[model samples]
Target: MKIAVLGTGGGARSHIAKLLELGHEVAVGTRDPQATLARTEPDMMGNPPFRQFLAEHPGVTLLTFGEAAATADGPVINGIDGHNAVAALTPIAGALADKTLIDYAVPFVYQHDSEHPWPTPWGVMPKLDPCDTDSLGERIQRALPDTKVVKSFVTQEQATVVDPQSVGDGDHTMFVAGDHADAKRRATELLKSYGWRDVLDLGPLVCARGMEMYAHLHSAIGFGLGQQFGGHFGIKVVR
Candidate 1:
């Protein structure tokens, strides 16, 4: 299966690496291919620039949003940060129509950058807009009503995409929510392919509200772990 993962963040890299590990043809979609490759420094997430990742994985192709989605012919993983996901995808709705779009975004607005949080790797987690009333998943589904949107992988750490055993303690849980059953099924299979052992579907795309809300907890964990901690931890469901 060919997959296109959107964005240049840590999540995107994780997805690309994991998809490659799963033997699926993978490409990355960025808003500006040139700017992404020209970056000289690491990103806010502390991950190396796109140029470095591309060098390491020469087999994977890179393209703009439309080209990545249209060329995929398979699932498109929205690996972008939650806040900018809608805008990034809105223009490519035509390419996503009738396609199973796995939404792995969290609606987080990074704050304290201008106010100067002292050049941290990234900004602290602030409540996202529309999160109180609507979720990123619902927002995407509404924007691309013709697309089959499945909300998933939002609750897990990106590293777990390839190393699920490292997720919490010994095979925890992941959640999937979407109005489209087939989309959820595809998302489930994708998760399983990436070594996710336990994934629970939380019903319709709207249920993403609860999943997104979990971001607060995730943020707290990140803060508690400090900036030096690697981005591989995940929350586990006892059940």
Candidate 2:
């Protein structure tokens, strides 16, 4: 199976590494491949440069966003940052048409003004735009009418998402929501391949509202647990 992961951030790296280990041909998408490769410094999240990651994991091809999306025969994981996702993906909708696009983006407006801003240990918490009325998943689905969009993997860290067994012995649950049953099934199958045993289908892309909104709670839980940044944790939908 050929897969395209559209981002070079830490979260994207987790999926890229896991997919490669599963013997899938992985093509990574970036805004500027040459600029990404030219970077020698670590990113804000302290992730090493993409060049180093590519060196360690040979045979992973890096290309422009459109080219990478076109190369994938199977699912295309949209790991692009939440704020810029719609703009970036909208331009490449042609390449993603008729394909199962498993989007896990939260609609976070990193730069915004509010009279009473929510402050976190790091800084002011980013605001969630289109919160109650709409969601990023629905926005993406609306933008790419020809694509099957499934909202998932937003409730937990990507590392914990790929390797669920590390937390609570894989007893926790995962969720997927989309209008297209077949596309949600594809996302579920991929989750199973990642060793997820309990996957709850949260019916319809509108349910993505809850998933994306959970980002704040996820961060709060991490802070409560004394993890200032990038905490390794998972939440279960006990039933």
Candidate 3:
């Protein structure tokens, strides 16, 4: 599959690495090519080397976010942080028409020196912003009504997102909610390819409100626990 990951953050890097591990042709879409290259080089320096690394990993490519989104054959995963996701994707909205978009984002507000206490150790949690009333996924869907937007992978930690094996016990489940059946199926397949064992379709784009709330709840749990507990949550399936 040809997948384009949008962003240069940790989530974007994780998606790129995991997609490569799944043997997919992955392209990182970043607004700044030089900056992305610089950021990614640190991990490869003095190992097999950047040039040699590229030779070995020919499937991974980096392109301008717009160009990559315009040319993607399969799903385009939005790994950009919640704050920048809509704007970053705005330019490519037309290109994304009738395409499947895997939205992995959270509407988090970063408040420093404010009266409200931080929700998590990371001082970030999903807070209702002015546009978030309809939920971020729904807002994105509204912006690109033609594009099929499926919300998934928002609750899990980046570490657990890539390696569910590290979570231990049985397995962790990620939630999927979207209005399009075909898009949900595609998102599920992509998640499975990245080694996600359990995926629950919560139904429709509106369910994104609850999904985002779950992310907030997870953050609250981490805050109460006084640590970054990203992979500590799981689902109980009862017959």
Which predicted model would earn the best lDDT?
2
Q: lDDT tens string, model 1, 18-132?
A: 7887788987888889999899999976788789998998688889988888878778999877778888899999998899999878886656334523332444446566676
Better of 1 and 2 by TM-score: 2
Colliding residue pairs in candidate 3: none
Where is model 1 poorest over a 10-residue stretch in terms of lDDT? Answer: 112-121
Candidate 3, number of clashes: 0
Per-residue CA lDDT of candidate 2, range 1-239, in tens?
A: 99999999999999999999999999999999999999999997899999999999998999999999999899999999888999999999999999999998778887588899988877889899879889999999999999999999999899998999999899898999999999999999999999999999999999999999989899989999999876788888877
Cα RMSD for candidate 3? 4.2
Question: For each candidate, what TM-score against the reference?
Answer: 0.89, 0.97, 0.83
Candidate 3 residue 119 Cα shift, in angstroms, is 6.2
Among these predicted structures, which one has the highest TM-score? 2
Q: Which parts of model 2 are misplaced by more than 4 Å?
A: none
How would you order the candidates by TM-score, starting with the best?
2, 1, 3
Of the candidates numbered 1 and 3, which has the greater lDDT value? 1
Which candidate would rank higher by TM-score, 1 or 3?
Answer: 1
